[model samples]
Target: MADRMRKPAEETKADLDKLFLEKSRVKETMSDVLAKLTANRPKDALQFIADYFQSTFEQSKRLDKCYRCIMMTHHSRPVYQQNIASAFDILNQSKLGKGLYGVTGSIFDELITLILQGTPESHIKKMTDRLSRRRYEAVTYHVFHYAVTILAVYKDYLRVAEDLFELLDVNSSGQVDKVYADLLLTQLSTTFDHFKKDCHSGIQAGISLSPDALHTTVSKVSRNATGKEFIDCKHFLELSADVYLSLLQPPD
Candidate 1:
């Protein structure tokens, strides 16, 4: 009985050791990728990730690893983070749609998680500002919608929700108003549910929010707000940008 008990304990210890070793290896790989990106060799780093993803037999496992690698980039130096974001844009424009979807969607999801977990305000602002200047508005909007859904799904995020509203009400208006607020909330909620459903089974490309659609939504709301205060087009865009910035802050 003693021998049998000792064997089980030893197996448990070995399993934990194996887990730690795998984690360390992953960290090392991500570090290497970051080094290449920072050195202006983004193509090489992307190629390495592509090879790793291709070599992995399990799709889910490969995606999870890819996600971790991309998330790790967010914690890198600001310049490198900008490089990685630019690399993503280049990939999206090239024949690397698979990498773009896997990496970009994961990056957005991770940013939302970090913000909800209480990252610092300044860091988030800097990261989002960088991304916006790089013309990643679609990704930024997607992240904002995700963050709002998280606040909706988990009632515990009520405090964050208040802060988000304040940020969205760009002109310091008391509220987002009923019509425009409802429209924004409904659109975000629907997209969030669809994205969540897809993510449950596997990673999917993020849904891009078209500027035309946003403009139309704003137009309708503005016209409807003839007699009352409402979030206008300019203020709406500013609020969206601010929300994006808020979500980008580094974790505390």
Candidate 2:
């Protein structure tokens, strides 16, 4: 009896690793819905869950058309890559971007340190390193597509992604300027601040922006040609998707 070992279950390292991967993926997939459900407290959560996934399924079909549209518009691999690189270039320049102010000394005001606010720095660096074969950095079409595929398999971020893109591309333009994106982010930050003031756990729940930050950001971005550069809608969508994905990671 002493020599013989009996356990209810036995899981080798491989089994445990596989289980962990699946568990992490499933949890990440359900995070948004779970957060929404908790916040809203629907009358029937079970039914709500079912409906959420169903709506997401329909959204996925439309999302597929988005990818198809991108591929079709480019028409060739080289063209697609060139455009993707251009967009990435815009983002790479903007991520650590320093806003300028009236020359007090040799230094610019540095109002906007990073446009991708609140995400892990490692993710931003990794993305930049990944796409940057040269001076510019961005998510390649293959990487973007694969990442989107992962999201689709998990929770279908397509709808959310689409909604964000349309909202950002105000004026219904096929592309949006970096300056405009800065303004939008500033507005979002302000709104979040307002909510934080009203709520108890505001710091944890909201992102805040100072009043002057907006004015300075606008001034700097508007003056720079790169800030005025128009990034393709699909490329912007990919950048935003990466931001959303990075937010899912637990802080180190």
Candidate 3:
């Protein structure tokens, strides 16, 4: 009897260890989702959260982390992610299924890839220029959110990526200057051709422009480039309401 009892205790200990290990994975996955949420890629962030829940469900066949998975998964939706309090509530709840997780995870994976490809360097420059005109308008707020959302949803939707970047591209020129260029050229080849091109472009452009022209262009772009131009976070909240309402409207 004593030996049998001891074996059961050992088994229980092993189970606890496994459970804790899975919990650790949940924590890491949660961290990853939070990071993505705060990044330029909210959709990708959502997908990451979804993927974690899905994977955990499949592997563990347990509900311990389901609440978080559900919360993050729901929050990834553009509408829900915008709401801090509601998102928090959902994140606080129960178990998710393995099958559901797998499907959602695949969807996110595809979206992320599409968004990334859409915003190539050349496209970004052109799109920024096109969209910069709305900088001072009320529409600018919607436009900014729209751009970010599009980037999130389309993930590498190169055509739309180009359009968004062109709208943001204040310079209206074909190339990115060295300073703004860094946003485009994140990776460096051993030859560094991309970096060199950007550097050369900025220097040449800087030299060619009169100081006044350069200052005007920079001023225009700088004023709205950082997210500070947004009157409040709620600007998007309001816009989303309108957009959703529009979606619900009857077909023309």
User: What C-alpha lDDT do the candidate models reach, one value each?
Assistant: 0.45, 0.44, 0.37
Question: lDDT-based ranking, best first?
Answer: 1, 2, 3
Compared with the true structure, what per-residue lDDT tens digits does model 1 show for residues 71-131?
A: 4543324553444454344323322234543334434433434443453444344444443
Clashing pairs in 2: none
* Residue-level error in angstroms, candidate 3, position 162: 15
- Per-model TM-score on C-alpha atoms: 0.26, 0.26, 0.18
Model 3 lDDT per residue over 1-252, tens place? 765667877989989998897745556566655764576454566586677567545433322232233234332465544543332233223123323222122222222233334344443433343323321122222332343344333232232224423433556654333333222222111112322345345444334333454455556556445542322212322332223222321212
Per-residue lDDT tens digits for candidate 2, residues 40-71, read 79899999788767754544343343334433
Q: Which regions of candidate 1 are displaced past 4 Å?
A: 1-116, 119-175, 199-208, 226-252
> Cα RMSD (Å) per model?
17.9, 23.6, 20.7
Q: Which regions in candidate 2 have their CA more than 4 angstroms from the true location?
A: 1-24, 73-125, 128-252
Q: Report the error of model 1 at residue 153, Å.
A: 12
Model 1 lDDT on a 0 to 1 scale: 0.45
What TM-score would candidate 2 get against the native?
Answer: 0.26
Model 3 — TM-score against the truth? 0.18
Ranked by TM-score from best down, the candidates are 2, 1, 3
